[model samples]
Target: MDPAVRMVFKNMTTDLAEQYPALVEPAKLILKKCNGLPLAIVTIGGFLADQPTKTAAEWRKLNEHISVELDMNPKFEVIKTVLMKSYDGLPYYLKSCFLYMSIFPEDRNVSRRRLAYRWIAEGYARDKATADRYFMELVERSMILPTQQSVCSIQGFDSCQLHDLIRDISIAESMEENLVFRLEEGCSSNTHGAVRHLAISSNWEGDERELESTVELSRIRSLTVFGKWKPFYISDKMRFLRVLDLEGTEGLRNHHLEHIGELLHLRFLSLRGCHEIFYLPDSVGNLRQLETLDIKGTGIAMLPRTTIKLSKLCYLHAGSGSGDNEKTYFSKCEDICEMQRDLCVGCCSLDLSDLDGFGRCEAFHLVCCLMYPNIIRGIEDSGVKVPRGTRKLKALRTLRYVHLAWGIAIIKEIKGLTGLQKLGVVGINKKNGPGFCSAISSLSHLESLSVRSGDGLNGCLDGMYTAPENLQSLKLSGSLEKLPEWIKGLQNLVKLRLELSKLSGNLETMQVLGKLQNLSILGLWDDGFKIDVLRFQTGLFRRLMVLDLFYSRMEIKLVEFEEESMPNLELLTLSLGDTEIAFSGLELLQSIKEVRLSVHSYLFGTPKSSKNGGNEKMGKTLYEMMKREEERNKPMQDKVRQELQAQLDRNKNRPVLKVQ
Candidate 1:
């Protein structure tokens, strides 16, 4: 049994420790039926946990019945029954959503975004964000299990899977309800009744003919093609479909999309991993009712102007989610917003080539301005152009990834979205000057602002810019000569990040930052300071908890926190070179909890080859190329090991160190 499952087993057997001692031997046999599944273990454990005596006698009675069922029914319907209880316990709204998961293969990791979109299309929830709650409920009930990363992340888990044993029950229940069917190529099975939804299982090569024969295609409202089966053209007869998920379908091209517009009721359409596609047909813009459009990794570089007509579309994961992971996080800002309103707006992303159509974002919520200049040029060269008419978005609270290179005219256009609370823009310079900063001050409601002026390029803010008093987080890059004076007025500032290499060596610059009474976390990157020593003045940084310092151009050899400075400091992350610094500052921090030191050293080296046939310029033979590389550990390694040993020997006599 896996350790986690074994721990659950131990916790369950606690009730029988004393009274049903002899029955434990029999209980182990019964537990084997669970196959070490946490769901099964937890389910059976709950049954024992509620026993009147919590004794072996009660467990023994349950065990005997389970034993008889196991012997008479090899499938161990007893365990299946326990799993079914969880499924049956689901709320009315979540039942359909849970069963829908049965379409996916067992042990397959399902994308949370994919589920959110599909669930919304199926009318399981009002929108994509609402549907996310339904998924979390299932995992909470132990009906599904989450991956490791999901559990550790502060961000909610994005994927989950079902145990094989649990999957079997879900499949059986799904079939019994006639809710959906799992179709495969070789399997010659047909659904008995009206199949409302169908999942063409992965590895299925059968085409449209196989689909028509197995199910009444017209009645199916939702169709999900998981693997490589290509339905060149969907039938016009399947009219009621509100959801068409072709996530991993192969060879979806211009012709495949010709009839898509006819499905008037379609709400969700996905082509997330369809790498075969290089361009999308203009007809895709006809799905006016479309709520979510995901083409995250598709090779298609530009979208048609017709997409601007999708007024119903709110969430658009249009470009590389990885290229700008930080910029793409549009939800975090919305979630923490203390203000809430029943407002509506639509957002569209325009590449340089698709500039003919204008998009919308409203009520200070979200407006993603693509801020990279070179990227803007590439997109414009590809066919993206500016919209034909004036676009107004009064409700947008957030504007993300805005590229100022779109022209100052674009800035004037966005100035109308006065409600923006969060904004991230790049491509600023002496040419634009404080006009960008002056425009930023107009967003009085803005709480978070991020501006990046590319490498070696300087942007001057000066006194003309007005910093929003409510601003809580600010990230600034580029050749910022000094922190703008407006920063002193940001009484609500909570987080600050700076990345400018030409930072002045002045200590007063840092002292001013530390004076921010409400600031708790600070990150200094790319030679944030030109000084050799960073000294914290006493009575400053009273509430700061995390301080991250990275080294690139400028190197700091010493960091000293004055006696009363950083009274609540908890974590200090240091990126340093071999220049020796003092460890005494760490002792001065009254609330110091952890020290993460990334020692920068020149240790990694490719040893020079003495005997090499490649030196003759003919290059090495296949044998040499295929040969295992030699490992080198020399006097440096030995010296380091000896020093480490000496440090350990010195510490051995002292008190043991504890890690928090």
Candidate 2:
């Protein structure tokens, strides 16, 4: 009846404990052998959960096995024995996948997508979906621990990490089987035999001379660098390398990849955070077997035209935001500066009245271009261009953040890539709106889509009356008269972000969004709606967990949450002007946990009042009114605090309230 023992039984056998009360004592006796170690208890519990029968005799047999293992081994060895027994129970397919986790460094959060792609590239699974299933199975077995979940609920866990104890066992097993070779600072370079997978970590003190002399590079199928990059590591000898993951590796230059094209068998190449590299060598076109090429967060703008030759490419991720050089350019934007310093808002609202023929979204881009032409040039030209004859890459599953400025011809080329599941394009305009829409509708497997409009354009997205039903995440930044009717049909949608859409206070649009059954995250940024009051009606947003409402120019006088609305909302973030706004119905959020509020006077370098004498006088009066409103609303603010505190005191999940 110890708490830990009871917890193990409760977690592993909820109904079994109640059904077979006679087995409780024997289960406790087995759990007692864990000696208060949570990991051992969980591992043993997971093993027992998989048993075909739940009986007193079976429980006694397990306890006897644990007693025998403990008696035969030392205290430290007992824990390892228990873990090894669990590992021995795993199916053959999962064993290799589990051992592969040893390639990652300690405390690293391994991305789910990255791991799945690597598993597929290693020939462990037929495809990404199959690899993902194997990942989940390991998680269920308590072998891998989940660290984060995806914004889209359907995508499941986003990242995972192995416990130190589990990782130690994996490292031992991998080296014993000659499946992986790990190189660290001051470690011996003697890899017993053929090195199939090489993981170089820490500050590697040895140079290419020591590596080349001790290790055989010819047979290295995968090379992952967690520390410094040695140029000679990618020589022509590594012909059989299938995965070259130099993600975040230091000292990597453009010239270092001169021989990358020779790795004809390379299926996965990720230079995700290598900031020094500007362009890939033309020789990269030789990677005919490449499937995943990730260069997001790099200085690379346009890829080599030879990229079009990668007919087998499945995932091409490039252009996340302003690269290293463009970071200085973004500093000039006052809105971005303010957001970064205090409010931390994702999107910035701009005043486009002075800029002719430009939507708010487009005006922001134009302003950046005008301020520092040279600096902004790289940021503006960040997206990868869809080359001509790109239709040959029919195997593509993901093509994200591509520049649509390539014109309708390039936009039309995307229509031929029918296998694309996730697509993101920037610089949409009225001229190619129909073509873009036509191309999108043809992608039957598209699950995620993001479209940003071009400068001086409106209604670019109005032509889309239909969309892929399987869409789970959609982000749109433009000017729309109303919410697309097609969005209401996307029953599978899980995360939706709308920026600078200027919905014109359409209450029907709110109703349409509230009806989405699977929506968990909703962001309405930079005047997504021009309404005076934002309200959540009763019985709506039932599954919503995170809600972000950031407004710059639009003054929302009140945000009312009707009873029974957003019952599952846990985190709420709001940005408001220096105006008195009532936040009602805090007690109704049964699952509320964190509330972040920011109050500011002006934003986006646009003052609410002009410096002229007459305007200054008006501003003084407005300031006085706001002061009086704040004084009058003191009691309401206290009431808000009291309700939040009450929720924290009564509910097991404590709520956090932050105001700036």
Candidate 3:
């Protein structure tokens, strides 16, 4: 027998085979029909793992089915036959969820949360939790594959993708059952009945008129467009559409959605990544059935007052969430640079003397001037302002990136949303900190909370005495004098990120953080601490797997790691200061797999050195100071790399060391 076949049988049916020894021979016969293909073997093994009975009759019956199917079909159809058998064996509850995978583009890494929301919108599951269970069920059965794991350990996976062969079979089965209509280039739109779900691929060549003429648009329960926006597709004809997902669609402007309110049946509307849209029509209030509204990467700064009418709104994601702030800023700037490059390319081909060409060039420059500043401002201050009556959204479970610039009253209103499981708010200041804390204390069910201060200054989060005990993920982007006392009580916290929090060598803060038994991911960025010598004591941070420490202003002399500290640490990211810093106890991290060292150039301003007196380098040019700093830090950077390499060489894992 093939070794792979034997392994699969042992892993899938170890208990069943041991208990029903008489059926072992028939199971082996079934494995032989797999032709040594891993996919076929795994699929067949998964099917058997979920069997209701493990008797000899059941084993022999399955063997006969596989033999008859493989003999009747060609060699190429063997895998398909095996996959179909697994699909056929799936419980009725999971069949529709599996078929729904066909709606996503081939090889697309679908967001787990987005997919769950869509499943709920389609009435496949009762809630997000239930939808997630359905997804994991398919994953366990080898029908779907996970591409990314969730940051919070309790949540199984972050994103997933379908195997190519699995996707092909899913597409075939979905079309055969008339469960979905995938519109692509050169494909006919004629269906046996009304199209319930329409997925327009990026390569779709049919025009809106062609689609309307061939299919009944009114019956489309869901519409998902992949690439360029087709204006005619959003007409009032799609009155029954429950899901309108135009995420990442190009050319989708505000005018294109002027009539969107006519689709009162829209339960899930995602305009995420449609940057061209600047405002939403007030008519959106007519969508009383809307439950999920995702406009994360759009240009809409404020939601219309009409949105308060969406009593069923459960998920509302507006501005950016926690991520690499510098990276996101540079990416937005890169978009502007790309536009400038395009303008330059156009100018090169234009005739200088032609008045029309000059006029076009002037107009393009005008657009650049008008759009550039807004994009930069949006990056610095990103959030959607909710109007009054927000407290009426009692059903809201997720509300992120709400701009407190709207008013302190918004915080008071948010407190009424006791059902919120995740909440993120930006634009916090000293004046509203108390109110914000008050509102947070009222939310007993919040599992994830993110707060960002309006300005990069300390003392904004000084009075927070209470927080939700159920929080699993917490992110704060303000300067705090010290870590909050209440945070030490959060035993369930798994992920924590602190940015611009000028905690200058507060020993109590480290002690408080080290005590979090469930904390696994920690990020300290932009002078989170300004200590000279940092040390991780033994038995501290036992559950941590990822640690990120990035500093631009502080000069640390050494970072000591004690034995038995962070035994599970898998990845470490540390910034090298201008002063020489020794990294002692590097071999203590038994599970370390990757270490990233970053050396940042002081290009913005010269660092204040007490030894050299403050502002002593004011006469020098910024570039000169930056060059001097870079030259001084090079030796220290090399020494750190060498030390890391030497220690990693002796380690069994042979951890990767990166210096940048």
What TM-score, over all chains together, does every model reach? Answer: 0.60, 0.72, 0.74
Point out where model 3 deviates above 4 Å.
Answer: 1-37, 40-73, 150-156, 322-381, 504-506, 527-531, 550-557, 571-582, 591-645, 652-660
Task: Compose the digit string of candidate 3's lDDT tens values, residues 347-446.
Answer: 5665555443224434344344355655435443477768788899999999988876556777878988899999988777766777888888889999
Arrange candidates, best TM-score first. 3, 2, 1
Count residue pairs with overlapping backbones in model 3.
Answer: 0
Best by TM-score: 3
The lowest-lDDT stretch of 10 consecutive residues in candidate 1 is 359-368
Cα-based lDDT for every prediction: 0.60, 0.74, 0.76
Off by over 4 Å in 2: 1-73, 151-153, 321-382, 454-457, 479-481, 502-506, 517-520, 527-531, 542-555, 567-582, 590-643, 646-660
List model 1 lDDT by residue over 180-293, tens digit each: 787765666564557778777776666666667777777878888776646543677788887888876775654466567778778878777675444456676678777766
Q: Whose lDDT is higher: candidate 1's or candidate 2's?
A: 2
Candidate 3: global Cα-lDDT?
0.76
Supply every candidate's count of residue pairs whose N, Cα or C atoms clash at under 3 angstroms.
33, 0, 0
The CA lDDT at 42 in model 1 is 65
Model 2: per-residue lDDT, tens digit, 156-243? 7989988666777788889888888887776776655686898888667777877777678887899999877776677678889999
